[model samples]
Target: MLLAVVLASVVFSAHAQSVPKPKEFYFDEDKTTARPIVVVEGEGEAQVQALVRERDRGRRQLEATAQLAHIAFSDGRTDLGGQLYQQALAQTDAKGTLGRAVRWNYAWDLFRAGQVEPALTRWVEVASAYGSPSWAPPTLALALWRLDRKQEAVAWFGAAVRTEPAVWIDARNFASQLPDWKQEDRDTLAEVLGAWQANPPTWP
Candidate 1:
């Protein structure tokens, strides 16, 4: 009996060890999940610096500049992020996916820095141009709410819900932060929240 119990414990321990840990996802300032940054193994900061050097030498300039911009934004260096984004945009096709991504990240940096107006403008651009990503509308709605545009904010909030049901929890949480929302708007948000709670969207 003692030997059997010990074997059972070992088996349990082995099974637990075999289970992989879930990957942690990070959100940007607007609570939008950030894209994963890929770094070369064993190179670390040296690899990023080498990429920047390669950009300066005009080899893979667009990719290098964008990656450095993302790193700067992730590190909270908005000034460097802005400059790098501009450099990348100059070399990228403004109507393409990469351009939209750079613009979105730059807008997020602006939002983090409290440049709400410009951030709103850029977010509007991103929504109009991309229109598919799940993050943009809710983020834009939060910006509008911050700027005291409650009506427009509520409209965008609904738009976000319709566009991405998976974001209902985040949108509801964000709506709760708007202290000056009218009672009617509050009621509307409450209804949406209750519905979402009852029928939660499946994770992608």
Candidate 2:
């Protein structure tokens, strides 16, 4: 009788252990993908770990992928983030606004990861697709500068100041940090900044 009771208890414990726990999910307000809710944990690292599991399960695949990519980037896993971003891009519409935002984010991630060539390609695509996203000017300028395209970098800085005057200060600050930028490029940026300051836009 004692042996049977012990055996029964062991079996019950094993059965319980075999059953997966129900995961609690919540909506991720920042993402645009369908079924954006994911499993949550207490906070910070624990939450991120839960997200990693959710990402692997293919639940809300695109949103989970993008979220994981962001978390990876924040955690200093830029290579993983870039790879995940590429996967997310494959799931997103190339012509849509979400696609543009994802591409821009991926480009920035690549740049931060020291993958300049790939970053340059993505930045060029962003610049060509939409005139100038707020981040495009400085980011594209940096990419161009890294590629030894000084003239193009100057042109983009001028475009930033002329088209998106609100980001002129950002562009100026970034341009000032480029070690390879020529005097001509600096002068061009200065000229555009002067023009923008002299004739500030009335509307935001």
- Listed per model in order, the count of residue pairs whose N, CA or C atoms clash below 3 Å is 0, 0
What's the true lDDT of residue 138 in model 2?
A: 46
Query: Least lDDT summed over 10 consecutive residues: which range in candidate 2?
Result: 17-26
Supply the TM-score for candidate 1.
0.57
Give candidate 1 misplaced runs (Cα > 4 Å).
Answer: 1-44, 57-59, 74-76, 131-133, 164-204
Which residue pairs in candidate 2 collide? Answer: none
Error of 2 at 110 (Å): 0.7
- TM-scores, all candidates, are 0.57, 0.55
Residue runs of model 2 more than 4 Å from their true location after superposition: 1-44, 53-60, 164-204
Residue-wise C-alpha lDDT for candidate 2, range 1-204, written one tens digit per residue: 999999987985564311111111111222231122234535587777777777778556666677778668868988788788889889877556667667766666666666766777765665455532444554555566655555555555555555544546554564544433455545555554454455543322
Pick out the ten consecutive residues of candidate 1 with the lowest summed lDDT.
17-26
Give Cα-based local distance difference scores for all models.
0.58, 0.57
